[model samples]
Each structure stands twice: as structure tokens, then as C-alpha cells.
Target: MDKSSGTVGVFTAADVAVFSVMLAVSVGIGVYSSYLELRYRSRALRQVITGALLINICIYMSFCLYAPSLALATVTNLSTSASILIVGTICTFYITIGGVRAVVYNDVPQTVLMFLGVLIVVLLVCKETVGAAEVWEAAGEGSRLEFFNMDPSPYVRHTFFSTIVLGAFVMLYWVGVSQAPHQRFISVSTLPTAQG
Candidate 1:
């Protein structure tokens, strides 16, 4: 079983029901807007979608490679839901105020530092697990080593099909819909610089 329940469990049936409604409504709106943007030949809309897709891909890859193994009993599994809403709100606020350039500049060093930290933890995990060769063999014994070991379904992270679909949705939302990201265009000194 999932083992997560009550507060620890991110989604209950009620939550799923609400989320399903929200998702359908939001997606319908997004699709309509995207159609309008494309019909109008809106460059700004195109750029935002493209940029969001790029960001999503980067994050997804990071999760695949850097995420620590988690079971139902893991600390994060228990606390993720409580923290996620607050964290997401804060992130949105910061991004909205800081604009695109600020976000990108801040993320550059953050990404570097995050990767460094991940590297250190991975080394430590390796040391604790077994000899390097044995570790590789052990990992290979599980499907974790397989790039697409998980089922290629929407339920999984990013199947070959879902990536394009979800990635496009993410791109459209980030580029076309987000006010904060578009603010960067006007915040810049000149149109050429903003375009760049």
C-alpha cells in the first residue's frame, strides 16, 4: 500500500476530486488562451511557453538524478503536503516581484550549489552502501538503473508521450500566462535587451 494517510498523504479522494475539477477548468482556460496567442502570432506568449518548458525539463532531470530514495516512512513523504502549498506560494511571490532576469541569475548559483550538495550526498551514500563496483551492480539489480524502467504512463513522471504534452502545457503557462515573467520585458531598459 501507499502507507501515507491523513495529513502526510498529499491527496485524499476529496482532494483529488477538487483538484480534478480545478485541473479541468484551468486546462480548458489555458488551451483557449494558447489558441488565441497562436492565432494572434504573439511572440511573448511563445517565449514564455518555451522558457517554462526549458525550466520544467531541467527540474525533471534533476529529480530523476538527484532525488533521494523515499519510502512511505521517509521524512519528506510525511511532510511534503503541508509544506508544498506554502513553499509554492512563496516561490510565486518571489518570482513575480523579482522578474525573469532576477530569477534566472539567482537560479544559476543555486543550481550549481544544489548539484554540488547532491554530489556530496551521493558520494556519502555510495560509501555507506558498498564498494563502487558493488554499488553499481546493486543498483542495476533493481529497475532504478533503467532509464525508463517505470511504466510509460501519465501516472509516472514523464513518459515519452506525456513529456511533450505536459511540457507544452508548462511552457504555455510559464511564458504565456505568468504576469511575473512578462513583467521582465517592461522592466528591461530596452526592447532589444528584453528580446535577447
Candidate 2:
């Protein structure tokens, strides 16, 4: 996809297959972790889970580091790899000092800003293209807004069953295993406060 225009986004069948497989694997790992937590109640298993989560966070952060470099490289006419390294180093240093509390606290404003940014972009796109109706018309013409596909083949890119069922499982796994949200749920100091 082109980073500058934002008009080259494309997802092939192979992309869908890879995404589905990765989602399935993530869900499976989350389930296994939950089972281990419940059955054995082992501290070692908890530590392992924590380590795995940290590794995932680092991988995500690496990707995040690269994303901004795309824009910075275009703006400054510098090498993308160099921009990525600079941004990544700064991020690594910030994360090392900031820790989990810092991450959690920053997420609120980050989420808000992201939503506002998307809203602004969508509004601008609609304005530039004349209206939102044209956008929907184009999507419908391209058959890109399908609500359901009854295809039963597992190899199919996107079926109703695959979207609804697999999507739910993926979300459930994310919420169940992710430490940031989980910590918020358990942060109350009192049972009454938690219940409330």
C-alpha cells in the first residue's frame, strides 16, 4: 500500500488466509495459557505468559516504529531505514523508562487522538470526493460491501461464518490475554469498588 496517497490498500486471498491463520494461532495460545493458569496455577506458567506478552509488545512496537518512518522519510527525503532506527531508538528508551503504568496512562489520549485523526481524514476524503454517497456508491459498484458470503470452503477468503465466528474468537482471545485491559479490570482495591 502507498503510504503517501493512502489509496493503494489491497488485500488478496493470501493475505486473508495468513491473517486468519495467525488469528487462529493466537486464540489457541491464549486458550492454552488460560487452561494452564486454571489447572496448574503455576507461577512459572504465569511468568512464561508474561514473557510471551512482552515479546509480542516488542514486535508490535517495532512495526509502530516503521510506520511513522514512512511519513518522515517522505517529508525529509531521508532513508526510511534511518528514520526507523532513530524513531525506534527513541521509542525503546521511552518504553524502558516509562514502563507499564506509563503505557496504560498514555493509551487513553492516544486512542482519543487516533479516533479524531481518522474522523478528520474521513471527513476530508468525503469532501474531496464530493460526498459520502459517492464513496458508498463506488464500494457497492465494486462489490466491496458484502454483508454475508455463504461459502463453506475453509480456503475461501471471507465467508460470513469466517468473519463472524473467527472474528469473535480472535477478539475474545485478545481481551482475555492482553495485560493492559486485564490490569484495568482487576485494579480495584476493594471488592465493593470492583463490583460497583
Index of the highest-TM-score prediction: 2
For model 1, the stretches where C-alpha displacement exceeds 4 angstroms are 1-104, 148-157, 190-196
Tens digit per residue, CA lDDT, model 2, 1-196: 3454453334344434543453334433333345445444566775787689789878976787778988889899789989988787877788689754566567768999999999999899899996999988998999899877899888888898888889987775566445555554444344555444
In candidate 1, position 76 carries an lDDT of 59
What TM-score does each of the candidates earn?
0.39, 0.60
Q: Top model by lDDT, which number?
A: 2
Candidate 2 structure, TM-score to reference: 0.60
Number of clashing residue pairs, candidate 2? 0
Global lDDT of each candidate:
0.55, 0.66
Cα-lDDT of candidate 2: 0.66
lDDT of 1 by residue, 1-196 (tens): 2344424323355543433343323433333235435444566755666677668767864464333323322555555544555455666688788866776457558889999999998898789986677778888887557464346677876566677778877775556544345444335555555445
